[model samples]
Target: MNFEDFIISPRSFKTESWQIGSRISKGIKEGSIVLLFVSDYRGVGGDAEMQDFTGVRKEFYKLSQLDFEVPVIDLGDLVSGKTVEDSHYILQEVLSACHYKNAVPVIIGGSNDFAFSLFSALNFHQKNINYTQISNIISLKQGESINEQTFLSKILGSKNFSIKNYHHLGYQKHLNETDSIKLIKEVQFDIVRLAEMMNSTEKTEPFFRKADLVTVNCDAVESFNDPFSMNPQVNGLNKREICAYMKEIGLSDNLQSVGIFNYNIYSDNQLNHQLLAQMLWYLIEGINIQRSHPKERHYEMFYVLIDDTEYAFRRDVFSNLWFFGKDENIENCIPCSRKDFDEAKKGWLNPRLMKI
Candidate 1:
């Protein structure tokens, strides 16, 4: 597939420019980080509203590359196909290309439906995929045609799709339907409420750890001086907290694909532009900061006999991270916080250990 044919280069930023172009050219030598923006919002299932991804892309490219060492490439904005499905196919092709090149694809999209395309593109790489999403609303509405609201359901119900684990973060209770929220727990999939996340960001890190793909709905962020997303929420994660989570998404050991969806690009707000750009920057920074583990370290193992069942725990002394399960590696072990580890010492059944 000729990716250049399907993507349009972004316009220059009004803010002060930096050495981003030079850095990206240099970074593409090894494993590069590629940016692909999708500006079509037709699948949002309303009057077609044209969105501008270039606003965010322009701001992203202008940011100073202070400590950025990773090879980066801007594939530029994706030209929407005649139909939404057409766009999905094109996106899948592009993502697959990036995957083959060992380039991490960071997509800024018009709607969350793009996530479905991302998952489809990623299907060939692995079985039993570990997927994580940060969104404000849990819309499982099964519509006649695929839309932003029904996309999640389509993914979950698809016969070909293989989902190992799905972790949802930053969901507000009021915005979500009672039964839809109930179903999350009834199915045993992880769902963290907005209140829980605001209380502690550390607890949510485990959800992103070793994740294959991560997607964030921009609507999950609270609107500040300007609206942060197309579907703006009056209450949600603040700018700092959302960016912090983005960094964590980049820190994943098995990180492959990312999409920041539901952003309100129709508005002419500099604050929104800056916010999204910085979010991307932090994510890239986190990727750069990731400690590549070529060498295996000895994990200190601890055992707790709960109801005559021996539940094991492991700790990586170097990273100061804890895990629940028998194996030591993050992939093999269930990611757990220090609190989960501490509970095991007192014979408490570690919730994280049980599910895996």
Candidate 2:
């Protein structure tokens, strides 16, 4: 439950990814906050040799430079030779215990697959708990009935889960498996495709609205963002675009937790570590913006219809609640405030459409 428990030194593991920082340690604690869960879980296997979580831990050190007090709990090792499901259950118990005292859990992970454990820990039992997933690839390989990346498939295929309220960003065209895309569409995940992000003028602001947790995957940001990554995809979003997206998402009114995963320190050069640091700073910037937004308010905007009909409405931008007159064409329209307009109209909002 202490900061010392969260960090692992490079010398502890004879692997490529764990070499950047001599010792991986948690950020400095200044807040009364209790537990923050972070770990280097690659020791178990599969892409273990390929993962380098050291850069992210380096980011944690930089975070320490800032003025804050929150202990980061490091869970030393991922249970070896166990299925992803087993890890999920194990982390679920740990996280539930950590959150019991209102502690914010920030997880540092080896792969996008790590999210399965974090999500399982979160439980998503309450309607108020909104989840947001950020990844360059959809990570939904449903047809691979017995594949390593079957976490998403299992979650969506299960009858017990109610995942209708989640949002997914950075879905690349070729990175997604066909069946995965089909499954994603069927599940109604709000996808902001790489093409759409590149082509559109807006950053993915709308998707982050009211989210309770933000899960980030380093692979989602092209290989350039993390040179240490072995399987970096060329078509991924650039560092700048990824930062902007994270900033917008972090600034959302309802976001309470944030996570960064899939960083491979082994493949990284000095440049990659620097980029990782910058990305972490941007993530914090997003949190700062959310804290600075104006207080909650119910406001109305009027628009004239082609038939000259006037619509009167009231909306809570901060919470995304809405009410309108019966005569208004509100069927396809949900209630939103000027906050929505501001977000939708932001200049650097969407980056999936970029030429890169």
Candidate 3:
């Protein structure tokens, strides 16, 4: 597929030698991070006409390169199709191309429902996907048409999509429907409240460690001077906290795709643009840092006996990351925290960790 046929080149921006934009190319390279902008917001009751991303690009382009080893490519805005379904098809094609090149696609500027397209495209190449989403609302309203409120239902209900695990983070209890939250719990999926996500990323880093697809709903972020998301909330993640989480998302060892959706495309606030740009920078920074780690890892094993049962834990000597399992085989291990290991020594175990 010719990416140029489906994408409009990003507007030219002047850049200094040390800036990130100076290193970003227009063409996709092997093992690159590809940025694709989608303007289709019809799912969220907005028009398909091109949304100006000049503010974001300007901020992103001016940021320091900061020793990044991975290539970055801006594929520009995706052409909106006649119908929303058509737009999904176009997006899938572009994503497939990125996958073929062993590149990670960071989708920007689309309605939250476009997450469905990201799932569909990745499902074609792999199964038993681990999806992690950061959204303030968890709506499972049944509908034939896909929109922000109903897209989660479409993803969870589709038989064609093989989701091994789904983690919904940053959901605010007051904003979510009781039934929807109940349903998610009933299905044994992980649903984390907004309060659990604030202040630190250590506890939630495990959720993203094995994620294959991670999507962020800008609505989960709090608005300051102007609205940051299409449906901004008064109580949500602050700029610093959200940027920290974005780095965790990028640090995922198994990450394949990402989407930043429900962003307030119409906002003229430079702060909002600057925040988004910084989020992207932090994500890329995490990716570069992870890539620098040793390919072959060694672990230190520790064991604790609880109720006549031996529980085992392993800590990577290189990364200092902990995992819980019966043995040393990494596949059999579940990503865990030092806190979990500490609790186990006291003859206690988190039931949720056992379930996973």
Q: Rate the local accuracy (lDDT) of all candidates.
A: 0.81, 0.52, 0.91
| lDDT of candidate 3 over 1-356, digit per residue (tens) | 55468789998889999999999998878899999989999989988898889999999999999899999999999999889888888999999888889899999988999999999999998999999999998999999888888899999999999999999999998887799999999999998999988898887888999999999999999999899999878899999999999999989998899999989989999999999999999999988988888889898989989999888889989888999886656966888888889999999997767873
User: lDDT (0-100) at residue 96 of candidate 3?
Assistant: 86
lDDT of 2 by residue, 1-356 (tens): 33233233332333233232223343323321222333334422334322455554455444432422223333444332244444455555655655555444555545556666555556553433466777766665555333326656665565655553567777777777777777666756567677656644254565676676678777676775445343567777776777677666656665545666665546547667766666655555565555555774644544423234344444545544443333334332432334433433443221221111
Q: Which stretches of candidate 3 lie over 4 Å from their true place?
A: 1-3
lDDT of 1 by residue, 54-142 (tens): 66666777778876778788777788887888788888888888888778898886788889988888887777888999998898889
TM-score-best of 2 and 3: 3
Worst 10 residues of 2 by lDDT: 347-356
TM-score of model number 1: 0.92
Pick the lDDT winner: 3
> Ten-residue segment with the worst summed lDDT in candidate 3?
325-334
TM, every model: 0.92, 0.67, 0.97
Arranged by lDDT with the best first, the candidates are 3, 1, 2
As for lDDT, the candidate ahead, 1 or 3, is 3
- Relative to the unseen true structure, what is the C-alpha lDDT of residue 286 in candidate 1, on a scale of 0 to 100? 84
